[model samples]
Target chain A: MSGNSNATASGAIERLWKPLVARSRSKRALLLMAPLVIFELLIFVAPFLILLRISVSEAGERGTAYAEGTWSADAYANVLTSEVPREVIVHSFTIGLIATAIAVAVGLLYAYAIWRADGFTKSLLLFSVVLPLLTTLVVKTYAFRPLLSPTGTLNSLLESVGLLSTPLEIVPGLAGAIVGQVYIVLPYAVLAIYSVLATMDWQLVEAARDLGASRPRSVLEVVVPQAMPGIIVATVISFAWSVGSYAAPFLLGDDVTFAMRVEGQILRDFQWPTATALSVVMIAAMLVVISALVAVLSRFGGEVEYA
Target chain B: MRRESLETALFRAGYLVVFAFMLLPLAVVVVTSFGASGQIAFPPAEFSLTWYESFFDQTDWLRAFDNSLLVGLGTAVVATILGVTAAFGQEIDDGLVGRLLAPLVLLPMLIPPVIFGVTLLVYFTEFDLQGSYVSLILAHTLWATPLVYFVMRSVFRRFDWQQLDAAHDLGAGPVRSFVHVVLPNVKHGIFVGALLAFIVSLQEFVMALFLSNHTTETIPVVAWNQLRNSLSPMVSVVSTFLILISLGAILLAAAATNLNWLSKQLS
Candidate 1:
């Protein structure tokens, strides 16, 4: 229980002896990180590089082809200029943007409601928001497939309730894909915004109210501004997730988005070069969006300094 | 006050509608799993456990479930060990290298799963490691490690190093101090991280889609293929079981680690 022993033992051990131990500590840290770094390089970095190499190579007559000549940008050119790839890229971004926007709006509303509600209602709302994150992606897609099928529950409900004269064609289309993506990504947005909401200083709202601000005005001015960082984070994360997504679009979209197009090249046509190029484009777009988001958030004093 | 009340009512209604929308498809799947009819139908004409029985009757589903459990447990164990150690290393130094490597550690989670899947697929094929459980577990660990790392890092950041100092001053070795002081404090974090890693590995599909094969097919892959190839309520039944398992895991983790607070930290 002696203070001097503890301080000398701990402080001197870490700080005063730092020069002597720095090299070894760093080496040990590097050694600890070696497994994770090596695994990431092997599984994540190497494949992308391989894809980049393959993208530049020329396709052969029948089997897997590699160019005997130097690397060229032909695959990229094809990905950029080709009608299908271009359309797919544009469509994918469009869907991603729209889906992200809708999710943010819906999630913000849901979070706001839950934050404002009292007792059991708040927990119930939060639980519902968190439920989708627990379900398997494929199972969710399959569940939607039946529900959105032509003669499915949605259509039957519509007809039985006299809401529609005909069964709706809900599956195998952009609408179905957007719905599925939104449902899946909504929880992320809610969680993000709710975190910000939970940490926010509620005293500001009380101050605004004391100063004659209406509830709506106070929320609009104080709550929204305060939660901007979370909103931005949620929006960017949702957009990136939606863009790179393969399952919802592949299963629900009747071959509409860039993801579906890239999936086709890889899974159906075995066009590895074009698919790899598309994947590169998608990753680049995500990095740009994320960087921009980080920059904007930093400017607003909302840096995500994770502990 | 009138306007506020109206706005609150409207928002409440919107929340209910959206909540119902989110739960609808999942609920339909669970209900259809109990259908008397053989096909996938919502609002089943009659309720029975036929599909559940058939689901159990199929060996393929059982095998896939076993594979999923094995892979999930393996990934969780590996990722947790690596994550805790790496995070501890970071905490020990709190220097530039740790800062630099932090984001890289998060690469798996930040990058799209498709990119991760394709990358791993290409990497595995090059090494002739495709279809091996090792490759699948490695791929999964890439995703799982980040979650465990983040959880453990936060736990370590808030850790009281004074106790370790006390133990050290009392003639305890590094290993002993860690075992007695560090482990006790971060045990909840480790448990939560492991739970999360397990749940993620269990439900992951895209990477598994590209990597898993006949011998290593996971529950998600099996359910995906089955749902695509056939029209039956059996998949629904299996899906319900998976959902229940995931829910149980999440709740258990929450109970173990004050998950309501943990969820906020996770985001």
Candidate 2:
């Protein structure tokens, strides 16, 4: 195994070195790539470096963002010990968990429906999924307010059906947040699962069903395994976006999520160190959780043939 | 046979419910935009275009719309150029460097926008570029380029590189060959990528909110400020306008490339 790894390593090195020495083609390629590399480094990488710096910097006075060049762990400590931030973290994770679960479950079903659909039905189904994706994130998310508010259409519909005498407040609540979050992520999840399902052979499920397995049993056995990669992708996308979401929670719900808290710290409070520190902590937590999620989901899927 | 029919019926019903869930908010917004009432009411007391007129009448809303358009167009142009070239770069250099570059471009897509927002807010402040059009466009380009890069990557894969080689052999320069040979073939991809980038820039809220001042606030940023204060039918009207623009762009993209091509790109 060591010898095999050595060969692979040497091969990788050869591939890397030979391109630089042997051909002018790589030179041309470098020229083409230069603009993007510099742009990303300047705008993407440099800013993150600034964020990291600011996170450790001492708190600035009123009207100042942060005390630059003076490093301290006070901001991290405060966030770790704080009550409001703790609740915000928990709230963010709760929304992420609930939204991911619902989005993935519904996405799976929606994908299956699209797969089974024929001709115009199939196109229409696909179009519906894509439509929301193309629509502005804030606009679609903001729509939930008018739809789910106390005097919104949903409550009116519920009342007319005699489901409730008066509207149960959903908007400006957790339920609204989850619903809005799910709506935002659901399209990508559907597409993720559908892309995998599109490549799957329906005959396998049919064969399983013909051999005495029930419909659900056949699907669970055949379709679920095949769709596992997509499900995992869907889950990760939903979870990450949900946890970091600003629009859904901000618009439809009044909850204090991590993103909202971070916003408050920077914009409203002008506590740059606290905001950056909180963001750094949240980002670290997200990376760890998402990595763990991928690891667990990969095992559950048996083996993911990543395309 | 009876069981199979029952299963199909159940599946159809289940699908309808899910579809309703997916489309309801958007449908409500569209319906609500036409409401003539001063207050946001459902099943509008009457249908009128007063809100749409109100949106058009307001200078603040109009300025926000203009800023959104300017930023969206600028981001689309910059991102498309970077993404297309990067796609070319990756395709040409399929070595370790290519592998490294591929993930680097896509990294922005994975990182949360809030982090990007806050970080850039600080970075731009230090540089004294805060509230400038340049900062807003550059901030948007960071997000949009990755999307354009992904789309163009897929586009490049289906493309034939032999034409480029032929153009080179015939003494056509890289620029000339790219412009004459490579571009015409992948025009559809370029159009689609640019549109997607435009849409991304147009809809993006968090980054704009963090970076923009009152003068530079995009439609979503303006809408967000308004949303916090009150529920105006004018906001709904603005949203409807955004929806229409996005829909038109999507349709244009679909026309440029088939629906299947679009769906495959989504994955």
Candidate 3:
């Protein structure tokens, strides 16, 4: 059966390209992809190159943003040595780890629930997730101010329920920042896991159960291994977005994140080189982290077992 | 069996809590939008449209809303075109160009928008195009096109190319086949892609914050400024309105395609 499946897959691949291989070499294929490639080069690639250049350029004179056509490693050196940038980077990574962990864990459970559900319940569960994906990020992040502030709804509810003697300031604090960050990334995380879960065969878990595997044991062995791809995607997304988060930290918390520092450099201090350098360094770090994550996760994703 | 039932009940109760966490903020904003008092109070003391009236009365807010609409529509059209063509080209050819273009297009979505915004700010400043609608639309298009591409790639993957083969076996030419046959089947996917792009541009704030000026400021940017400066109910009204637009777009896209298709693209 496995050999037959492999033959079918190979045949399908051959069929997919038999007609297109000839046309791919024609000018039409180049024409088809040219506009988008050129647009990306001009808009996306060129700007990053410029950002790289600015990162190495010397700080500008009193009136300027950056000194054009001058080379200096001062900005990079400053970023490495300066207390503020170092603190901001650490803070950003901390938030990223925390938010990514929570988002992935909760997202897994939520996706499992949705997958286990049927009919109207399943659709409703899925729709609720996508609804937040479409809503404005800033608006939703800002709403946390009213919902979690010291005198906000959560505190009031807790107090009324006799859970608290006084309202504590959750907003403009670390807790608010994490909650808001998790909220921003949760929908994507759920969707990612659910997408994988939707395609999974439930009988694998049932078979595990029949083999005397406990419920949690069955899920850990059968479900999580299969869902590894989605988990990786969700982790990278939540981590990267949280690390470079702007709206949540800016609106709900007083913590100075890497993004907020970049904003200050550009808008307030006019330190273009520093801001660009900081961004360049963080982007490099993010690439390293994400690559490592994908590498490690794919190892777990290897060799899916058939029931 | 009793143990299984109890476990299922506990799992459901936990799931409902997660669902509430997701919807809490948006529900708060909607509820507060109708608060009659000057302060933002939850479970409003009284219901009224005073803030909604204020939002409409303010010319600056209205102008920002118009700017957001303009940018969103522009992004939708440009992103859909680029995304469809690129996905089509990549799908047909499994070559070096397709491999290269696949990751290159998706790079924008993965990178931090703050970095992208600052880079565009510097890039546009060099060209004296900073704070212009063209700059805002271009920045948004770069961000949004990747989403459309992601969606359409999956759409094209599941596409029945046998139909294209049938058209080719007939007397129809390549272009004619693509126009008459290839496009019709994928039109729903195209519509959903465009709608997704529109929503992305409408909600995007980081890039617009850097690229837009007072005259060209988008609704999210304006809302950010207002949120920073004041806790006005008018912001709530604007948010409520934006939420409605996003919800409506999602419903429309859902109607055009289906939830299953959307979920597949998401992963």
The best candidate by TM-score is 3
Q: Would candidate 3 be rated incorrect, acceptable, medium or high by CAPRI criteria? A: medium
Q: Which stretches of candidate 2 lie over 4 Å from their true place?
A: A1-25, A302-307
lDDT tens per residue, model 3, A18-69: 6555546755666688789889999999999999999999999997999999
Candidate 1 chain A has its poorest 10 consecutive residues by lDDT at: A298-307
Error of 3 at A235 (Å): 0.5
lDDT of 3 at B90: 78
What global local distance difference test value does model 1 have? Answer: 0.79
Q: Output the chain A TM-score of model 1.
A: 0.81
Candidate 1 residue-wise lDDT, A266-290, digit = tens: 6567777777877888778778877
Q: Which pairs of residues have clashing backbones in candidate 2?
A: none
Of candidate 3 chain A, the 10-residue stretch with the lowest lDDT total is A17-26
Indicate the residue-level lDDT of A191 in model 3. 87
Relative to the true structure, candidate 3 reaches a TM of 0.94
Candidate 1 regions exceeding 4 Å error are A1-27, A65-70, A117-119, A292-307
Taking the tens digit of each residue's C-alpha lDDT, what string does model 2 give over B78-105? 9999999988888888655566787797
Residue A7's lDDT within candidate 2 is: 100
Candidate maximizing lDDT: 3
Model 1 is docked with a DockQ of: 0.54
How much lDDT does each candidate structure score? Answer: 0.79, 0.86, 0.88
